[model samples]
Each structure stands twice: as C-alpha cells, then as structure tokens.
Target: MKRISTLIAVATLALAGSSFAADRPVHLRGEVTAVGAGDFVVTDRKGTKTTIKLPEQAQVLDVSRSSQAAIQENSYLGIAAAPAPQGKVRAMGVMVFPEAARGLNEGHFPWDLGDRGTMTNATVAKVVKKASATELEMRFGGKAQQVVLDKDTVYGQFVPGKRELIVVGAKVLVIGASAADGATAANAVMVGRDGFLPPI
Candidate 1:
C-alpha cells in the first residue's frame, strides 16, 4: 500500500482548515475527560480542552489483544518502537491498523512513545523470524524502515469498542471534520482500551 502523504489522510490534531467541508478529515489525540449522550470531552497534549462531538453513525474501535505472529508481508502497521544504531528501529509494541484505516497516518515520524523512538505507518515488505527476534522491512512511499520485534513485543488490533470504553480518562484519537458548533464533528473515534495510548 502506498503512503497517504497528506495529514488529512495520515495524522492530524486540531488543525485549521475550511469549515464548509462536512466530511473533511481532522485528527486529534487527547485524554477523555467526559462522556455524554452525543459527545465526549478531550484535553489535548497541549492542555487545550476541546469537545469532540460524536455522530451516532461514527465508527468507534478499541485496541484488542493480538499477537506478534499476526505480523505479515503487506500488513499496514503503526509501530511505536525504540531507535537502534545505524538508523534501525526496535519494536516494543505494534498496532496493526486495519485495512479500512490503512494509509491513515502514512510516513515515518517522531512519536512520544520513547525518548529516541519513532512511529512508522507503512506496509510490510517482508518479515523474517530469527532465533532471537523478528525482523521487518516496512516500506512507505519511496522509503523503508527496518524494525526488530523481540520476543517481548506486544501486539494490538482494532476491534469494535463497546460504549463502556469511552468512559473517563481513556486516551483517544478522533478523525473528523470541523463543525459550526465549535466542537469537532467526528467521523471515527479510536479509544485505547484500558490505559493504552492510541499509538497512531
């Protein structure tokens, strides 16, 4: 899969744009402070409080349990991994973004997971398991990222999130369009199950 280079097709948060496009995709990451009938409150990384209005038709998904064995060639993945020598990346956790969310945040960028860590949105070009760990060749656009998944690497998958997952203090990422009502009008929301941060 080719990487979606634009932020609207990749990652975004509280970005400014035209408000007239009802289906314009915006991205947000924050902590859930409240949940009500049709909306939830989020305080972004910058400590700015924003209301995220969820439409009844919105898709809500949770990060469910998964395994490293699920890693395969052609898989679209969001990897929050550590940095290694020679510009390699070491995987601590891997989230297999579903086909529907493929190219949602496509590119290699710095993430807050670790001090020197990075996030890569790409398709698996190859996967090889060695005696000690698994090596992955992930390609995005014209570039490639090398990732090593050790035995202790954790796995996460997107699953349908029950209403209970939207409760207080959950970390979330919302993809939506601007609304005249000030609150972001979301098309989809991904809430991390338990205390897991939405790594994408």
Candidate 2:
C-alpha cells in the first residue's frame, strides 16, 4: 500500500508539471498563407509553417507603420529590448501605443524574444536624438529606465482590429497558449496593416 501511494503522488506531480508547461505563452511572427474555418497557417521568416487555432473571441489588434519621428516626448510606448552596456537596454522593437492603450500593462517584464530579453510598456519622459541613435527616458510604476533605439530598430502602432484582419497575406505577431500536444491556440493576434509587418 505504501509503494502504491508513492506512485500515485509521483503521477500527480508529473501531470501538474505538464499542465503548467502547456500554459506557457508562445509567440509567433509570420505571414498568413492559408485561412480556414477556425484556424490559419503562418509561414515564418525562416520559411517554417505553423497552424494556429483562433478562438472566436480572441483579441486582435492592427499594427501599422510607425517611424522614429513619431516617437516624441511623452509618447506612451511598448519596447522590447535586450541588455546593453552602461546599465542600459537596446531596443529590439518599439510600439507606439494609441491613446486608448496608455497604461496598458505598464511595467518592465521579462520577454520571450531571448533569454535576457525584456518588455517595457511605459510613458516617455524625455527623448534625445544622437548622431546615430535615439535615446528614450521612460517612466512606469514610479520607476524610470532608459533604452536606446537605432536605425535597425523596427516600429509600429497598435489599433483596434477584428477577425477579418486575419486573412491571407497579412503579417502577424501571435501570442498563443501551447498545449501539451504541441498545438498552439491564439489568445491575441497583432496583424500588420497596409503592407506593414508587425515589428514586435
């Protein structure tokens, strides 16, 4: 009886671990190549294809082209960045949030872009343009941070969108939940608009 009970406890822990793994967020960036009744296929930049299940009520946002000129003082932004020298971070991509999105997820957090990547959703306190790059002083949750953006950094703006925007040929950044069986179901999708690809 003692051995049987230990085996059951071990099984329970294994099941719990699997459940937690399945709940991890999956991020995908690609172009829609096919659309079906309830799902779509995306071909990533590396030419790998993935089928993603889209729930009926998944949140969708349209990402439009944005430029460095649009990033001004006091602009609320979401920046994906990686560690840099001198206690600063280098911007991988920057998203200028719409007025309605101010304060949305406003804080610095770990991101999946890489092992040390981070995401900062904050309000710009100051902007400084250098000969080769731009620097932003951002504030969120009473904390201030600095990030550097260069010409290689991509930019976009988020707007409201619907399911219809998930059609073929559209580029998208998908945030989804992965299942134990390796399937992914989208929780939110950011679709690029007007031939612009989502930068983050």
TM-score of each: 0.62, 0.84
lDDT of 1 by residue, 75-109 (tens): 88888788887878998778886666666657787
Query: lDDT per residue, candidate 2, 1-200, as tens digits?
Result: 32333222221111212334647567788899999999999998899999999987566776788888898888888888899888788998888876555665678877756559888888999998899988999999999989999978988876567789999999988877778788888767888997677776
Best by TM-score: 2
Q: Runs in model 2 with CA error above 4 Å?
A: 1-22
Q: Residue pairs in steric clash, candidate 1?
A: 10-104, 12-27
Task: Give the poorly placed runs of model 1, Cα more than 4 Å off.
Answer: 1-34, 37-59, 160-164, 168-188, 193-200
- Alpha-carbon deviation at 28 in model 1, angstroms: 8.8
Candidate 1 Cα deviation (angstroms), residue 123: 1.1
Scored by lDDT, model 2 comes in at 0.77
